[model samples]
Target chain A: MREPRFHEVEGRSLAYWGLAALLAAIVAAGLTAAYFMEHIGHIITGMTNQIVWGVPHVVAVFLIVSASGVLNVASIASVFGKAPYKLLARLSALLAIALLIGGLSILVLDLGHPDRLIVAMTHYNFTSIFAWNIFLYLGFIAVSAAYLLVMMERRLNSYSRPVGMVAFLWRLVLTTGTGSIFGFLVSREAYDEAILAPLFVAMSFSFGLAIFIIVLMAAYRWTQRPLGGAILERLRNLLGVFAAGVLYFLLVYHVTKLYEAKHRGFEYFILGTGGIYTLLFWIGAIFLGGMVPIFLFYLARYRHSRAAIGAGALAIILGGLALIYDTIIGAQAYPLTIFPGMQVSSSFYDGVVNAYTPSLPECALGLGGVALTLLIVVSAVRLFRILPENLADIAFDLDPHEIGATPNRGALWAPADGR
Target chain B: MTRRKAKRELDAGRRRFLGMAAIASFALAPGVRLIGSAQSSSPASARANSKVRWGLLIDTNKCSETCQACVSACASYNGWKNEGRPTDPQWIRKVAIRDSETGLARTLPVLCQHCAEPACVEVCPTGASFRRADGIVLVDRHICIGCRYCMMACPFKARSFVHQNLTDQRPQAPRGIGTVEGCTMCVPRIDAGKVPACVEACAREGRGAMTFGDLNDRNSAIRRNIAAYSTTRFRADLDLDPSVQYQGL
Candidate 1:
């Protein structure tokens, strides 16, 4: 093996600076809102006895599903043995770790007492899906972080194949567990279906792939490099496949609910009620989120353009958000009972029955979570030097001998790289 | 094939038949006795027996919306202060239920069902909640670990947990923070040979919505009323064989 010269890249571009500024603004707003929620208590939020969980939960689940997408690069390299994804592994792993932390932070802040979160871990109810989710989420964060470490460490790099495999398998189980939290409620009548778990898995792939593509494109731009035409085409093809899978799962999920008619009230809330939420599901999720992205990716010339790929990625991310929001909101939209010949009105919210509006504080905490995610990603990139200057160089690194020539091998261990 | 072998085989078959006979007798004995006793008992003895187990029959139709007298009386008798919140200590709660298809609403007052086979008792790890010999489910707060598992196990949602600290809680029902509680059918009143506070309150209100009597007493007011009018238990799918019955929904 020959020694390779160190290439000192210049500071971040204007685009990076702009993104950082926006992220900081979001974080500041979110933190200020969170401080009020904490000091004033949940009374400040729109949440009441009826609608206990609102936009905060919606945003949390959105980030969680998006975080699931971080596993795609590792999954392709370890599970499917795709060589082109090898160089992007560490970067994807770091993003996955950061996203989970962001998701958890939002969830913890949403709780009645941020201090009592340890109780959620210590007080285990084996039967309650919510209790089980606490454990599963912790496991996901640990495994993703461990895999990231293994990817970045020179000594542990050889163990990447096994570590990556475990990380991939764990995410699939974790996402399924997330789905089961809703699906296993046979008594709820609203969520008594087997398809939710599998649907969640499909969603994890779609959202995961979308985030990966966007981040990879940005990383390429930051390094003043370009991804190979063939590699970009391949990624676009995979995104198309994922979009189709998500669409199929979503269609079957809703159709089955309609067929059962057990949860007709909730079903009607999503489809029959013509409102912002309905528009979000039909237009944002089904069309732009699902169909348009697939169509763009399938077209060769469109898929090759970086801007077009970014647009498709954005559409998918927005669609994933819409899908999760629909799931959480749709379930609680109707009153719990619809017994024949019973006229019961809600006592909580006056006049407009079954209402929900996320308070300003809730919105603030959600934006804060996004800011935290970007900060983690930016800081990790600065310390780890995971981005490739060019796609051709990335292809070269895929070979075992060429990896030895990469510079600053010792810098991978520095504490500043902490995600 | 041999004489000894034949003897052993005969004994084994005899034991097997005996075991089967025992199971068959066990299954048939309750139904047979129920019918047999129905024929044998005289009307007068069935009406006035003190040894018979007391139960309540509530006519939900006659229950007025303003008739929270039962809840009030139960709370007062038990010495439970009304904080007027759902999370507070509530011995009895009135759940407003509406029919999904017809959209008709009715308020059903619910307390501990005092089940023959109580799920809360079964799932209680500390044995804090237990069913008495007479079939009343009672919680020993002294032994309660405050796990709240019983609250989750209850299908009717009858149990409430004390979430706040209070020094002024009444002595009769001096519940501390982190204890699960529900209606006790006014055991203290029952010990004094009086009807439960709720039953007395209902009777005083003149609607006669509640009738308390010994269920084992075949000719008691509750048994007779149940025989004359149709009654139902909430969530009968649980098959808990609840002592409390409701009529005229």
Candidate 2:
């Protein structure tokens, strides 16, 4: 087999420039929104004292989780010693770092006092989970950069395994830290579950793989590179399994909450009475995010079809956002259980559902984070040799399924089993 | 070697002098002198000590639904008056509770519980939300980044995020937009040897329902009230060890 050479994308194309301009415009709009919010106050936005964290948190969390998840490709190749994924490892590391930076930008920009960010870095409250997250997030970025450097340098190739293991462990801790942000909040019924840490880890897996597939396909297709069906099959299978893992964790979270008589109100609110949250969980999270993708992975034909797999990945992304919304905003909407049995009423919206309507500015801010992440990924691929020349003849490195299976040949979704 | 040893000796002497100076000033200050006699009947002005946990005892049986002096007083004092907005900050508010089984209606003012193991202080990223030496939970606005994680962590919904900019902030409270604020138990008044404005207002309205004193002092009115009645801590199951105790739920 001839060794594959790396090539940078020709960024001079009109299509490329247009896409870049569009993403840049979105980012600019987001920055403007953040500025106005800071200049005037949070009163301009839909977020209230009641629903403290809104669209920005949901979007930021999604990006942060996906960033850690994006590194799975590199981890597979370097730590797990899967040869086929080695070609995609550099791009994975790049995306992981870029995505985290983008996520952090949105989070910091949306702060009550963005200027006081200096205080956040300077002050250390060891007991606070948020404080620990600062270290975990920054460490992940540094480790991922080192891993990428090792992958790029031929002389440093031997160090890739140890560094990759470190990066992998760092990502797990990062995602766990993110989940524990909610889990440590013993005050709220929706949070305070020990399972939340591992649940977030699983969520990172599913959301990250879904995004990786989407990016991989886009990069391969736009650059007119040969992305083989065999690689897609492997990634899609992993995505499906992680997607199933997400559902299992969700089940455990809800069941645990339901079993506790004290937490029953929270369960009822999210599952039954909570209007938008309930719909999002049922249709968006469970059905589209989990079921459809799992179905796609199970059917041999859909699994091999890039278009089908891409669609499933897109659904999972949307579903993941819905799940975050359900967790952050929905939980806040339900008033704290101050008085257990007595019917309590107050001027502070006590025992009442705090209404929230996401305005244009908040929505723009969220979209800006997404656009910023994609902008980095797109720009990186263009400036550097991040994409492989071809994966057409790459053999399956870690599985026996490749032995008897024939490759699918079609434009879109087609039967690959020679039926 | 001789020069280094002499310098080290001088440094140690300077350190000893500074520590002694600090202790001497503290002992001589009026606040520390007053704190020594804090167990007295008359109002005591003092720097708070770990041994003195200031708290309030509310006799709900004497609390009347027709009277809202405490609520209005808190609003005016904290400068958190309702601006007719859905997101208006409420530091302390009158909570009307009705028992479903007995139809027994009771009205009580709810504020920060000032828990020993405050969840807000625990979850705060910057440790801006903190418990003082006297067990008074406070948000140090200087360092608070207003992430509102403390607001989420608070079980009583006692904290409020300053959603909008303000021009006329109370000089005593010192609040601003984009930072979380809550009932401070009138820390300034407490320091000045005066009961909280709400407690005074309640008394002026001919309802001495609220009692404020040092909980650690066995002879204190607040301590005696708690011992004499079946007092309840809000959400006792959480075991936050709230300084504020309530009677007649």
Candidate 3:
């Protein structure tokens, strides 16, 4: 068995500069949009009293959830001791950190008084889950950074497993905290379910791995690095499993709500006649995000096809967004049941479906967050020895037992399982 | 003779000590009052007492669906109006409700419940949404980051976020863009030793459907009415202990 050599990306190419510049421009545009929304007020955006959180939040929440999930790749390598996954560990940590920063940027910038962020930082509201999540998100970034250091530095190599274990537990709690943002709300019927926490965890795994596959494939192909089919197959299969887990949770969530008389209206709104919400749930979340990816991964003929694998991963990402959109906005659109047996109407838009259309600036801001994530990842790979020099099957064809002892500070790496 | 003399001396010292303590209390009274007044303030009403729970009772039976006097009064006093948009802040609104089963209809004014335990107060990431000692829920404009979690958490749809900047905001009511605002229960008027604008207007119209009083005071008009009538709190199933109660709904 030989140790895999790691090196920094040569980012001097024209295409590299072009991509970075494009991302930078989008980030700038997003900042500009935020400035107008802040000083000019939220009226400039599509956000109103009814739909307070719009496209920016949908994008932000998606990134934050996926950020926690992206670290699973490193957790698999270091905590579970999966040798094949080890090659992707550094990039995983980098991507996780990048994605979180991107998501957090959107959330902060979208605030009504983004300037008063200092107040949020200083104030202590221990009871609020949103307050707790501030620390959780920050702690994850800190922990993932430490995990990356332990894996990269031979001087701290032995601590990787312990740190990885901490990160793994932290991410699970982080996702739970994220889900509880909605789950804890007694007012909204769509969010009050206990299953939302685990559902988010499942979603993270699927969404996280889907993006990882896309990034890994793109980075390897572009860098002229050999990403082995063996690892790809393993990751794709895992994605299928995670997607199925999400599906199972969704089913339980709906069935349990259906059993309760109080939740029947919400369930019907999302599943039956709730227009876009129902379409997103069925076609976007269930069919595209769930069934399509799962089927693509499991089918015998498409098993080895790179195009199928990539498409399946892309489908999962798109579907994950749709699911999140359905979860966040769809629930909000359903009018709140203020009166149990009464049909209420008021000047306040009460007892009626709230209308929301995403403004362009909001769309730009949302896209900016995604671009920022890619920009950070793109920039980091060039600056640090985050990517392995090779991931060919021949390089990783080693015994599982020999993999954990991987080489020193930015020097040695290995793929553990070939048996 | 010696034991009796010692007991007399101790009693004399105890009397002297009590006199000094009383003098110290008198000296510290002004200082204590200054500190108390500096810590918090009531803009609309005189000092809110912990013993007082300002509440409202609305008799839906007497409320006319055609008359929006209370809503108009609230809007005028709070410096908020329809502005021809759904996004406009409604400090108070008239909701027309119809029973789906019985085909019975009722109209009532809906505003911040000023709940004893408010969902908005519980979920505000910053302690911006708060309940005062007198059970009046208020939003601190400086602390509210406009996350709108309070709006989402509020079961009554009581709170509203300011969608746009305003040039002519009332000097009295708290105002900020990217911040949440709701019914302050006319704290300024209460401070001025007056009823809320809506209550005053309702009374002026001779409808007298709305009553604002201290629910804690057993002898108060609101408490006496509650004692005599069958009343309902909106979404009582959640057990929020709302200060506002409706009769004959």
Question: Per-residue alpha-carbon lDDT of model 1 for A30-129, expressed as tens digits?
Answer: 8787767665556577654334456777787777766777778777876688766766676777778778888878877765445555555554545455
Model 2, B76-181: lDDT tens digits are 8877767657668888878888889999988888999999999999889898998888888888888999899998899998888887788777888789888999
Please list the residue runs of candidate 1 whose C-alpha ends up more than 4 Å from where it truly belongs after superposition. A1-25, A338-341, A346-353, A392-419, B1-58, B68-105, B110-246
Error of 2 at B214 (Å): 0.6
Residue range A1-419, candidate 2, lDDT tens digits: 34557778888989999999999999999999999888888888899878889999999999999999989989999989987888889889998998898899899888889999999999989999999999999899999999988988889989999999999999999999999999988888899898999989998999988988888877777766666677777888889999999999999999999999999998999999999989989998999989989987778666456688899999999999999999999999987888887888877788888899987888888889989999998898888788877755343342324532224356353333321
The candidates' DockQ values read 0.07, 0.59, 0.56
Best by DockQ: 2
Model 2 lDDT on a 0 to 1 scale:
0.86
Chain B TM-score, structure 1: 0.74
Q: Per-prediction interface RMSD? A: 6.9, 0.9, 1.0
Residue A95 lDDT, candidate 1, scale 0-100:
79
Error of 3 at A21 (Å): 0.8
- Maximum-lDDT candidate: 3
lDDT of 3 by residue, A12-67 (tens): 99988998999999999999898888888888887777777889999999999999
Give the 10-residue window scoring lowest on summed lDDT in candidate 2 chain B.
B38-47
lDDT of each: 0.69, 0.86, 0.87
DockQ of 1: 0.07
How far is B66's C-alpha from truth in model 2 (Å)? 3.3
